[model samples]
Target: MEYEMFIKKSSLQQKMLISFLCLIVIPLGVFGYISLSISKQTIEEQTITSNLKTLGLISEKLDIMASDLTAISNIYFSNEDLRKILMQPSVEKTYEERAKKEFLTKMIINFKYAYTWLEYYTSILGLNGFELHTFYDGRVEIDELKKEDWYQEAFRQNGSIIWVSDPSPKLARTVSEEHFVSAVRVLKDFESGAPLGLLMINVNESFLFQQYAEAMKDYDQLMLLDANGTIISTTQKSLLHQNIKDTKYYNQAKNGDRGSFKDEIDGKRMLVTYHNVKNTGWSIIAYTPFDKLFANIYRAELLIIIVFVIVLFLSILVSYFIANRLSVPIKRLYRSMQKVEMGDLSERTDVLGTDEIGELGRKFNRMVSRIEQLHDRVVAEQEMKRRSELQALQSQINTHFLYNTLASIRYMLLTQTAEKVDSVIVALVKLLKRTLTDENEYISVGEEIDNLRNYVYIQKARQDGKLEVEFQIDDRITHAQTLKLLLQPIVENAIFHGIEPKEGTGCISVKGWEEQESLMFEITDNGVGITKLETGGAADITEAILSRGSGMGLRNVNHRIVLHFGEEYGLKVFSQEGEGTKVILKLPKFVKTEELISL
Candidate 1:
């Protein structure tokens, strides 16, 4: 209401000033505020998504690595030669019996070095209590490995593989200072289900960091935490193996939320994002200072505000000057119009100059002089439109009559018989006479189907009784009015493309029903389907008529249906290779009325 009052009270010049100011000032203010809000959020979200994507890739890589290790372990477990050598009693072997042992040693070494990620491997056999190591001293007893934490916990899993991170004493014998991520699996006999031994594959910790080093450059800190919230991997090496369950964003990540937040961590305000690595049940967390992440948002807002103030002042001054220049001329023209409305034809504005206002005055005077000329042309155009409509109606009637007469003649010539030919002649005569007399665009569905049946009878004789046709029209839609001649062309196309191309007997079925306030027609045929002629899409009827091997009758029929009704009431085709074709016709379910019949 307040806005309506302002619109009423404001003059053209004043309103122009207000509207111009609003168009510039309001949008500028809104865009500035929205940009400031969106910029920070967009940047933060992009950072989080980037980190999450990197971590997800690393987790997948880890899974693949674990799979490779398990595959290698399965290889050794199934090695019967190694199993037999390990199970043999020491008293039954000597220096000459070391062939299997030497070959097994070389095989493990080749397996370890073949995979770039595999740093070391160990197999602790429980049969004869012999320990085989890829990079460690090969003489270690199996009883010694039982003392390790990873070995004890792995056996507790009962044959399943387990991942143990940052193992003590490492696995690279020469570099005990370096930490490793180990996969431990217990091997069992394939047939006996008896525990054979334990197999371990150790991957260097530095190799995991190398995979995501480029992505970690943007953050001040990065940590990969296990399900227990213990730091398994970190850029800050000192924090490795430390518990992070007390961290501010740890629980949110564990709870499956991936986003950034501003919070104080270890005495500094930081923006942090954490995402869970689904395969490993570990969280990858990235942190940067709050000021560092959103510094651009603050600077952008300040710059936008400064520019907005200057532009607002300039817009007000320019709009007021331009509005006054334009509105003054219009106001003078309004006064002259008032004089002319009072029957003063001689009245004219003396404030005319060589501008748009002067041209408007000149055109206004000329328009009055030519008013009668325009009226005469309008009447002439109306007469032309009426004649064109009448010509169109006459042409449709003549075309239908000519087709029926020609079809009747063709049927007579093909049969070479004058006896018992009166039925075809009588149907053609009635069809031609009816088409010549009726000018209505729409006819009852039953009448159209009857005319179609007559046409089909003639076509059957022309095709030498090769066409098999059936109609399953619903009684509910028999009284509904539809555009005339809608079904004949579709049925003809089905006969030529669908029926004629097949070897054995082909069938054409026409079905009609009412569906969703529309009249639906389905013309289906079992023949060498339309797929051989063209692909399955609505064939452009106009183009199809000109292109050889394209369906001919389909385009003409679709064209007439669209002309009488509209685009929404036309043909849709479905065909399959070597199966069949179905063409559907849609039209409005309108009942015949006196008004429509007269049109």
Candidate 2:
């Protein structure tokens, strides 16, 4: 219930990923379990059957070798040439010693010429104490040999052929350091029914089962055990002649002629096959561990697990890609909604999907656009109201200038001539046309200079020879556009504050030029400078100028420059007690007329 609740709470992407994992994991489990189960059984069965067949073949090989030893022994025991030499009397044997020695040499030659293996065979004349061997001289006394268990067993059998294992000291054909195993029999004369001599045929133990060791690489061990439970031939040299009668492998072999069984030997699980040779009563046994038997099956199980993990990982990635593709658009839409909730009406979804998510995103973009439209309309209305208030203030300043100029004209008409009055009125009319009218907020530099000339001419009329003015402007910027009354107010301030207080003729110079990306204008006068400049620095002087009674026009010009351009483009004032004031107007050059004309 908890897992189901978790799944229900998960996002669609997580749910899809979990479903994909289930699809991959469950099928992999079922496939691996079933495959390992069936293959394990099939591999074990085939391996056990194959080993049993190998054991049977090894047993047949032992039978053939045992039969060969018996037949060769029988041939030696019944030879008539051997009877003639051994039966000769002692008094006659002395004269026939050469003949006896020749007879032994003939026996060795016959054995060597007849068989490629050349098994060591021996013959002893019991009557004369003479003996001969194919490979080694007789090393043991005949009395001691007769006391051996296999020797007595052979004597008791009389002439019947029997096979026995001989694991003695190591034997060599030249030096005799190696020992030879022999199948021995007592030779009995058919005419007398008495044993004449002993016929011993030796076989090398190492040569037995030499071919089978290389062929049976998968089996852990291949052993040949005699009827007496002695290991005669085996792949392990340490187990030679070792008795295994008490072991489970031997006990199981003793009960059956030829068969296979699965058992635990010395803590190891083994598939054992055994075959008892019919001729020799010897058992051929093989012990194979279960791990070796199921080697290929284990490798197949590892391969299955690797493939399962790879497929599961790939399935997860594919599922995650699909789930993320489905959910990312919705997540982006949610984030965009959050931005709008925080008052960002400009936020819009840019989802690329064409499903319900895409429809929702398109709706969101349209809704934001609509909200932005309403916001822009409200902002425009508020801006229009602000502009109306600014224009009303500008009209008040215009009315104040007209009142001061008309007062000066009325005073001039009372005390001066008509020609001078007419020139002042004409200059006032031109100044009024440029400053008071709202036909254009900006004008070319040459037109603004004309406006300045008219205003200066009227000021000169007011103070006759008391004021002097000069215009020093760059001809290159004559066509550059700027505010219409950019310089008139500064020139007026210089005249009244700087030139009017001086005793000598005050000269005013208006200089305009380009400075990098801006237009620079300097209005200077040679007259009494600001007396307040003694009390403070340049900032205080500028504060006094912008905050004084007659400096209102200068402050308004500063405000207009800042409002039209930016804060960086405005008026700055510098003055001293004895030096006249200098006012600089920094303005932009060649502004795109449409951008700020409406503002």
Candidate 3:
């Protein structure tokens, strides 16, 4: 059978159940394989890295020990008895004999005591061997006696220490059976800077090999090489002292690289990691049997394959049932959409299953219902907006009438013979307009000034010029926007509540200027002044505007200004009892819409 037919031959319900089972099973299989591989690699790499760090720490501790021995030797070499013995030759026979005997006795006792200290530190640092040597009169001797190439090399290198050298003959007669890898140094006089002798330390090769054996316990083979790529040590002694030119590890270590590779060693297939110690010029190598590292991974892969085959077989049996169940509702919904397209808005699919397809059908039906309701709400909102616009227009028309009346009264006073009659009419016009005009909603500083001028003229006329009105305005701020009739209310309050209630003619001044980016308008009246109102009632206006809502004209002006320009531009009233009243209007400097659009 074709693959597609094979997949579709099962029942819908069975297909769904098989698919869900496979979805869960496949990832588990993949995750097991990946996790195993990564974990094995990480552990192996960390093991090797940790070993390298430990070796580096060991090498550093050895260096410090060598330095300490050198320091002690210098102190002993500088002792007055030893120095005097060395400076006097054997020709001064009697003095030389006595000095040499005393010097030898002192040196032996001091060295033995120093050796105790050295042994303690080396033991703590896990050092394998330590030695001190002295070279005098062209002869090299260690512990008052000695042997071979390391000593010769030390003298040839002009008293400089040889930190690392290959396996060589044992220095002390006591250690004659074994060879050693050694570090050696020379002692020098502190003040004269003259060479004294050599200090040598040798480590047994077998001890290091034992450490390598433990570190690579699971591995098939391991080796260590010196700077020249020659095998210095190995887990198996047969490979020790072997040259790298004869082995694969030699060519590999020459690269100074750390990595894994496949090779045949001792007739067994192996995987190896090679790393170099940059400070000591030694390379550490580890090898494992190829089968051991990957054995579990291969077995897991086989198990996954078996599980996949079993699942695949079961999947074929169930595909048809699952496909049919899933497709049915979708087909029903498609039919409903066709009905909807045909203008049958009431059409909806029957949902019998409790899956995503069922949920989708329910949501589609709800969406259609919401759209119909939203259509009705949109129609109603448009009707409400029409009524609100009409109300706004009527308010604007009423404000226009007040503006015309004030203009007419101003014109009559300017032109007619009955000036006093014209003045009374203008005062009445300004009082009515300031109290009722909605044009104050949004106006410029220039327009607000005109309103205030009409208001002050009316107030002075009412008091029969008992109040002298002074106006000072900055020309620079004239075009800035502010609420119209803002000053008229404050001026009226001052005259009626503060000035007229007293006996004498009073001074009333209105001034406006720009302070930084804000336009500040101040109205000060020094009439009778407001003794009672100045003390605490000055702040009452804001509370009255917010709570009692009595002073509608002042409240309206305050609210409109704040709504347009933010609360920072609202009115503030200040007064001192029996002193004067100051009302400050803080407004933002903003250009008119007509001027901005024209620009």
TM-score, cand. 3: 0.37
lDDT of 3 by residue, 236-261 (tens): 77766666765765576456445556
Clash total of candidate 2: 6
Residue 31 lDDT in candidate 3? 74
lDDT of 3 at 146: 28
lDDT by residue (391-508, candidate 1, tens digit) is 4533543555457556756667666676536667776666655454566657799998998788677666556668888999999999988766678767767876778888877888
Question: Between the candidate structures 1 and 2, which one is better when assessed by lDDT?
Answer: 2
Flag the better candidate by TM-score, 2 or 3. Answer: 2
- Candidate 1 vs candidate 2: which has greater TM-score? 2
In model 2, the clashing pairs are: 170-177, 170-178, 170-179, 171-178, 171-179, 172-178
Off by over 4 Å in 2: 1-375, 378-386, 389-393, 396-400, 407-420, 531-552, 594-599
Ranking by TM-score: 2, 1, 3
Let me know the TM-score candidate 2 reaches against the reference structure. Answer: 0.49
Candidate of highest TM-score: 2
Alpha carbon lDDT at 133, candidate 2: 58
- Candidate 2, after superposition: displacement of residue 87 in Å? 25
Let me know the TM-score candidate 1 reaches against the reference structure: 0.43
